[model samples]
Target: MNVPELFEEGWYWTSTQYSPNLAWSQSFDDGLQGNLVKDYEGRVRVVRRFPLN
Candidate 1:
């Protein structure tokens, strides 16, 4: 897909995490899947998914 399409899909996924009406908690399941970690300033962050087995 093009960059714009990819960005829109990403935005949709991120927004779902903030939805209050979802049946389950929307926080990332770190234990179930590895994630892409980035260091911003002094803080470590997981901004994307890693390989899922």
Candidate 2:
């Protein structure tokens, strides 16, 4: 079964704060993760996890 199917080829923002000028980001298609300038505009993804315990 398909889950969370928002798989679009684009960059997304992450909560991992890098610095005053850059922030962490990730891609959905190519699986590229890196930092980009704070002024750069990209897609955002907010995720939540449930404990298996």
- Which candidate comes out best when scored by lDDT? 2
Native-vs-model 1 lDDT? 0.26
Give the per-residue lDDT digits (tens) of candidate 2, residues 1-53.
23547656788999888998899999887888999998998988667767664
lDDT of 2 at 22: 93
What are the lDDT scores of the predictions, listed in order? 0.26, 0.83
How displaced is residue 12 in candidate 2, in Å? 0.3
Candidate 1 clashing pairs, residues 3+ apart or interchain: none
Among all candidates shown, the one with the greatest TM-score: 2
Give per-residue CA lDDT, model 1, range 1-53, as digits (tens).
12332232211122222234332112232322222222211222335656765
Instruction: After superposing candidate 1 on the true structure, give the runs of residues whose Cα lies further than 4 Å from its correct spot.
Output: 5-11, 19-53
